[model samples]
Target: MSNNKRVRLSISQKIDLLDQNATGQLNQTDLGEWAMKKFNLDQPLAQQTISNILKNAETLYSNVNVVKNSKSLKTTRYPQLDDEVEKFVADMNNSNLPVNRDSILRYVRHIAQVKCRIPGKEISFSSGWLTKLFKRIGVRSRPMHGESASVDISSENIQNELRKIEELLEPYDPVDIMNFDETGLYYQQPPRRTICSESLGGLKKSKTRLTVGLLCNSDGSYKGHPVVIGQHKSPKCFKTRANLLSMTAIGKKHEVVYHYSTNAWMTNEIFTAYVKKLDVAFGRQNRRIALLLDNASVHKIKIPLNNIKLIFLPANTTSKLQALDAGIIANFKAHFRAQQYDRALCLYISKKLDNLDVYKMDQAQAMFFLANAWLKVNPETIKNCWQHTKILAFKEKTICDFEPVEYPTSALPLEEEIVAELNGMIPDLPGNFNNEVTDVSQLNLEADESDMIVCYTANTTNNEETAEG
Candidate 1:
């Protein structure tokens, strides 16, 4: 009977309380008067509030009735398969005697594809195909994580940087250590793509979704514009490879800089040409590069491959502990989302929502819109977004999920290679979130800045709590 209590109420409990009190004998006037006395409500406010509440009670009741009706309306009747379809089912049943998930999906997808091809699209299997398949066949597929990328990270190079930074940090200020990395931005990349197993889903493509990679700094600054790659009709090997290699350069003119050549920054000529470009981007200085690298095998080709002094981040840590992730990538993803939405809207206005058509709308115009929006964003804004974005936590008793990662075993001068888990101390979160954080950053990367330090974490499995489809 008492509404006044220190405890919080669950949604259902609050609704039940409203029903119990509102449906009781008191009229609105009495209800307001009673509330004022019983619940310590202000006199005038109570009267107006209770008046509005009473008027809306019928609408709330209507909502409850609608929910109840929908829940109770249940029917299960298998629509008889056509004679031809029936024969197929009979053959499968007679041959196998048991239905499997893969077979079910194969059959269903084949049927759905055929039906979809028919014009007017009148042929629908069921609105419940997703739910039905999930229930009957079940989705065991999941998004890829850290180890899916082979680690060519040169531990020797990293150890060398660690030795140098450990000496530097032991005496100097940590803020001076600059940590930087490159991350992909999904512009046309279906920020919301349907995922399936890499092997079985011959139906799925890797670079199918458009993606752009960015070179990022530890303090949350980017050197140049993110490579604005678009989606391919179907994913191409070299195109995906090229797009990933993309990252804006930094140096005095042209000098070997970061650890690995990206989809963007690779040297077409000898390594010195790239170094000369880096020199132009970053003036020659005593700055050591703190690198957070994927353990891809090809990374071992450094020194012989090029000439940038470097430090390597610990294995399996970029997304977990990298300040860029904490500061930039997480925020960038959110900012990029809104950016994409606005960009999409703008392109739609011109009756050209296609990626390529919109791309031609003037690099100046595109930069103008993004710069206007970007000016409003900053590191704090992005860091705050990182606080809310869902991350898949690792769930290991020991470290079984951690595989033996290879360092630089050995490598030729010019081979190319390209780019985890937890849980239960706390409930796992959805591995990703499109938080409404709109903050853009003002930080800029100074090539003359000191050697940067970066850290990140990766696990074998990500929990489903924060998992998004």
Candidate 2:
């Protein structure tokens, strides 16, 4: 003569029940009764329900991030297949292979047909299945490219190095712990491909490159002046305007430090000078910084400095350890490319440039765009990259909040009407435009034996010249 209602507990509530049951003070029936009363259920939970919850305690505990109202953990139809595919995706991604929705779909379909081999029936996977698979695997679509893929950094080694880094970084605030790294800037490279009026007009990839060194603190509150190294000490483009090559001309607004090398590569002398300047600047501000850098030969300079303690990452681990490589550089490149695209579109609109001419830019324009791009990189993006490296001391319970680095399609000339109007005109875009273009290439600035000898000879020559003077 009693009316009672069945109730499903949330994942969090189930975890609490498991914790209470773990005390070993109550039997299943007692625990069920206790849970019903504690959770204000209409009826005591069934003994079998309590037993099942306890049996899946580990799963419930792991799913604490599920929505508060979520009452069930749904199982996939093919858990084994899902697991294998997930692992495959992880392996491909770790190796830096291009794996996108189409690739994943092809992979899953191949597995189903060849491995599953269900008689007479073709297992079909839809967008829903792919979406679910990505959700279950806890990954999002990302554009991965560059030399980072070539470096195979072991997770175990990264963990060990992180532990050491954490201890060293403990004394400093997040805002005070800084990381610096350089990336090659293919400044003039256009999108690998773009919609044109005629058949796709692709151009040879631009080899015009500059090496840019970026530095930022863990909190991203402070961004150091970017160092832009190009092959020309005073490129012909800068000569058009007086004082154009000087940092003073670009002025305090951009705050970029311009340098030059024969090949636009970072060298020991350049890095030493850069750090010495930073050390002096920090000293002036009465600030002490624990600067994290990769163990590159160029970074091994013996610079007598105050207010800066240099912390080098373990060799070959920069791919996983360096903060800039995490996503900040990629983000910077995205912004830079967006601005580049904007310039092209503007020129095309103003009738100042024709199809292929739209992509053409002078070194001076490239420098201004690069400086603006550096300024445009979000501080939040910088902070997220630092956290993503996990070089800081913390148990990051959840996945990193960084969105996948993507080319800013908004800046691309992708307006349907515009693309439709230009349908047949041939515009030379960047080569390989089909694939995602992200710059994660942190070239090893380590000097080879020959390069080291050259650097040493150069330094000796410079010192002797100074002495003679």
Alpha-carbon deviation at 360 in model 2, angstroms: 2.0
TM-score of each: 0.35, 0.57
TM-score of 1: 0.35
Q: Which candidate gets the maximum lDDT versus the true structure?
A: 2
Per-residue alpha-carbon lDDT of model 1 for 138-254, expressed as tens digits? 233344433313333345764564455455333322222343344443233333443566633222222422223334333344333333333322234324444322221122221
RMSD of each: 25.3, 29.8
Residue 390, candidate 1: Cα error in Å is: 17
